[model samples]
Target: MTFQNEEMRYEQLFRVTAKFHSTMDIDAVLEEVIHTLQDVYPSFSYTLFLAHDNTNHNVIPIKEIQHNVNGENPAVMQAFVTGFVQIEDRIAEKQSVLYAPLKGRQGIYGVLQINAHNAIIFPKSEIQFIELLANTAGNAFENAQLYQQSKQLIADLQLINDTSHRLNSNLRLTETMTFMSSQIKNSFGAMEVGFFMYSKDSLEVLLGSTPFFENGEGEEFVTFSLRKILKEKEPLFISDLHSDATFQNAIYRSMMSVPMVQGNEIIGVAIVLHESPYYFSFDKFKLLQSLIHHSSLAISNSILREELEKLVITDYLTKLYSRNHLEDMVQLSMETDAYGTFILVDIDDFKGINDTYGHQVGDEAIVQIANLIKDNIRDDDIGARWGGEELAIYLPRVDMQTGYAIAERLVERVATYSNPKITISCGIATWNKENKETFQSLFHRADNALYRAKQSGKNQVIASENRVC
Candidate 1:
């Protein structure tokens, strides 16, 4: 309280204020606050209660403000809430506690507590000095936070830019989604990522989704997300899935689901998850929205492209491969495979069915036979509409006996399963690596054998003789 002591305090305050302004680092500012307080008030114990728990200072006595906790110190909370200093005197303990708000122009960030041991009161001048130091620290903290936020914003923009560029590079749907999944996992530290595409009013998990979704463990999450995204048509940021009544036993605590929207429609959803509660910040949720928005158009384009490609090679009525596609498959099989079977199937008396029941019935009979062929063939086999009322099946790596048995099975299935009851004549032709026959030759032989089956019987299978020209 002497004139000399007041001048010295003023000088120290000026020096610390300059130091606080010299760096934008939050840790440095916090350390300076603690050092200055310790140097000036060595007799008093000090603690800094920050609003957020992100800062790290091992030596400084720092704790998070428990705003909602019961039985917390009223003086500290009051100083933080009111942005004013609070003083309490404990007469029985012969001590006084002072709580100073770390107030900047924007708001109060924390409370600075000074416990004066063995004292019932603090001098007015000392309280004023502590208040000044607390105010300086608050301003420095605000500036450091702004600096860090601006840097993060720049990085987020760069991530969105990179993702958008890659997605627009004409990558297929699977490739684009896989790249996006990797980017989100690495950037957000997510434990799992999934991409779901809307198909025929339902959501189908894309290939790039993590194995957690494919293995059926993520069905609940998918169903929940699908319902919410479809109903709300907005992104979801769940801090803790376990807190929800429906997901009481959820393993993932944090979740973010952003709908991939194009124009007015939601094409799909991008979901990110983490095991820790409140793992994703609000800023990250916003960034995810931006990333999905930029990538949605590219994804929509890829889906449309794939659909168009499918239509090009697919038969419209039967959903089988077109004759051109069948030829390509047979040629590729003959070049690479050791042996293969080609079965040319013909509906017996197709003209009679058209005359009796109409052309629509004939088409139905053809579709029934195509479905039977699809059910009986392996996934690698190619089933095609060879022509009107005629279907073809190319089974790669199949030998002569297996091919004849498959043909016989198809002949029986068509006779039994076809509506309006129609039968098919099937001709089987086998080719191996030794027979250097063209696709045309293979087709001619199958067609000849099919003619023989039709002449021999209306509902039977015939295998072509192995005669290489």
Candidate 2:
């Protein structure tokens, strides 16, 4: 190499370094690097490709464009994986391709590829300069990537914080699930979103946005996906469900099922599906994992709240409405219905049965009578454990005759079905719109009738009419 050429190369290298250092923007830096390389060799075409995730060992190009060519060249990939400059000589083609790894302080960030139009010799000095330029560009690319990742982290944290606050704000479980599903679908632009509750007896799927194709087949696929995840107890992602033998007939191309894991147990599952293959990114999947992780706690709390409320209003032993709940129901029924029947029933000789067979058998008898009342009444009718050995039933929109018949039938059923041959004495009272009866007044009338029935005989039904049959 001549001193003149060496001095010229020195000037060119200084200019290229200064120009490349002018921008922190990665794309601008790459453009400058490629342009500078072109200035050094005008007959050559240059290309640059970078990895989507620097943490991932496998190098896959996030960007497809490379100079005028469309796809990644094997030589460029080889250079990137090897972390070296690969010189491929093709004498028959009369050209050589140069693939230079963009080496940063940590690792190779990408590859810088050059395709010469004709056979050319790269002096040792010029190759060293090219490598130096590639290294500079690689560092700049990494800096930009780190900056972007930090910004993304901030955004993701804000989203999670906002979502947690919204979800935990005293919403019903179904409402919370709906809100969560909508948030995920809208944020990710997903084709389908489903929130499901998993239990031994019940498997419920709440849909947020309908998919492009949904029918019986879609439902079957959802069930299959849910069962698969529950049995495996792991997250599932299928990029191409249609091609898989397990789901070849399904319409969805991509699916993601993430369990709502709380501690060691899975409380539920969150699912998102798309019509196209490879629709979700790793970042999106991470966000979902975080979303469900946080939401699971909220869901479990909501379910517990509902159960607590049920305990407050229902009798734990008989599974009947408690006295307070029945009174509330009576008030509500009076406001809605013009009239109704309130039947107060007492198990005949309940104390004797407890003394003879023990409290356990007494409880069994009560439960048996409660079940019969529950089974026989209309859904609008309310049955309650009014007090010890006493059960009450409120039938809305029923006349006195209907109320008497219902009470009489219940008396017969309890007597026949009970194990120890227990019988009941029932007091039937009717409420009318014109009477404007308060719940307390109606309850007193029924209670008086019940006392009269007990005074008269054990097993019988008596109406407020004092007509005992």
Candidate 3:
């Protein structure tokens, strides 16, 4: 080669290296490498095999090295593994193939193959130039990869921050899980997301899980995940569920199962699934672990808050609503309902039972009556422990006749179902929009009717005199 020609080649290499250093876009860097080589050596063909499959330059001959079939290119593998250049002289084909490792300071990123048609051997100077170009491309690729990864890390942190803030805003458990499911579906492209809470020794599918789990279609996955999580107490990242012997026919190929941990215990498991194999990357699995770790405490707090609220309005012994809660329901019903009925029930001869059998037996009698009231009433009906030996039921939108019938049924059920058999007296009252009755007036009428029933006979149902029955 002439001195002028070598100097010109050096100038081109210098300019391309400067261009590579200026831009952090990986595809642009890769394209520039191929274009520079084509300009310098038009007779030779070039192909770049990258370790990561993120580039989208259709015009450039770029392939992922990881996807290469075994035994296809032993020289390319050796160059990547040894971080050195390799040469293969195809004497029969009268061609020389060169493999140059894209070696960065951190690691090798890819292999660049140069095919010299009709050349038996590549000169040392030509190999040196190609090696320099490959090294420059490798450094640029690493820098671009690191830049993209940093941006992704920032986005992931923002997502976790937003989710943690929203979850801690005292949202209900159902709402929190729903928000999380939506976030996972949008960010990770998950097909199904499920939150399964541990209750006692069993797993209970929570409200925000997809219908696929709630309807029993995903029971096998749930059981498998539960068993693994319970034993390992660690997150699972599965590339192909079908690869496992137990899940050979599984429809979902990719899965991530993270334990919702609080302290040392795993309270629940969060599962995300996809139908395509290897859909979720390891980075995504790590991000999910972080998300669930931060959200678990908030979930636990929400659950505890709901349970505490329930306890506030419940009677301890009978497990019925307290008198205050009954009053609130009655007040709300009177405002919204067209008409409603209130029944006040008292255990017959409760003082006699206490005197004869002890207060424990009397308390048991009150609980028995409370259970009977619950069994006979609709779910919307409010059953409360009014006081010692007295209980109440408020049936919203129910008329006088229906209320009387319910009371009569309770009277009979208590007599028959109560152990150490007992009877109950009931007084029923009805109110409608036309009557303009306040909650206080409604309760007074029910109390007055109860007095009348006690006077008439115990274990009988009576209604306010103004009402028919």
1-469 per-residue lDDT for model 1 (tens digits): 1222777777878998999889998888888888887777667788888998654678888888889635378778888888989999898998989999988888889988888888888889888888898998899989988898899999999999999999989999899888988999999999999888885567788888899986778988988997998888778999999889988888899999999887787778888999999999999999999998999899889989999999999999999999999999998887788889999999999999999999998888888888998999999999999999999999999998888888888888877877899888887798888978888888888989888888876698877783211
Kindly list the per-residue Cα lDDT of model 3 for residues 1-469, writing each as its tens digit. Answer: 2122567777878988899889888888888888888878878899887788664577888777753436568788888888999999998998999999988889999999999888888888888888888988899889988898999999999999999999999999889889989999988999999988886668888888888887878888888898998888678899999999998888899999998877888888999999999999999999999999999999889889988999999999999999999999988988888999999999888889999999998988888887877788889999999999999999999998888888888888888889998888888899999989998898999999988888887888889864333
Clashing pairs in 2: none
Runs in model 1 lying further than 4 Å from the true structure: 1-24, 55-59, 66-71, 199-201, 334-339, 466-469
lDDT of 2 by residue, 355-446 (tens): 99999999999999999999999887899999999999999899999899999899888878889999999988999989999998998999
Instruction: Order candidates by TM-score, high to low.
Output: 3, 1, 2
Error of 2 at 430 (Å): 5.4
Off by over 4 Å in 3: 1-23, 53-62, 66-71, 465-469
User: Which candidate, 1 or 3, would have the higher TM-score against the true structure?
Assistant: 3
Off by over 4 Å in 2: 1-49, 53-74, 102-106, 118-140, 167-171, 188-245, 252-275, 332-341, 348-360, 377-381, 395-436, 448-469
Models 1 onward score TM values of 0.87, 0.69, 0.89
Kindly report which residue pairs in candidate 1 clash with one another.
Answer: none
- Please give the TM-score that candidate 1 achieves against the real structure: 0.87
- Highest TM-score: which candidate? 3
Candidate 2 vs candidate 3: the TM-score winner is 3
Better of 1 and 2 by lDDT: 1
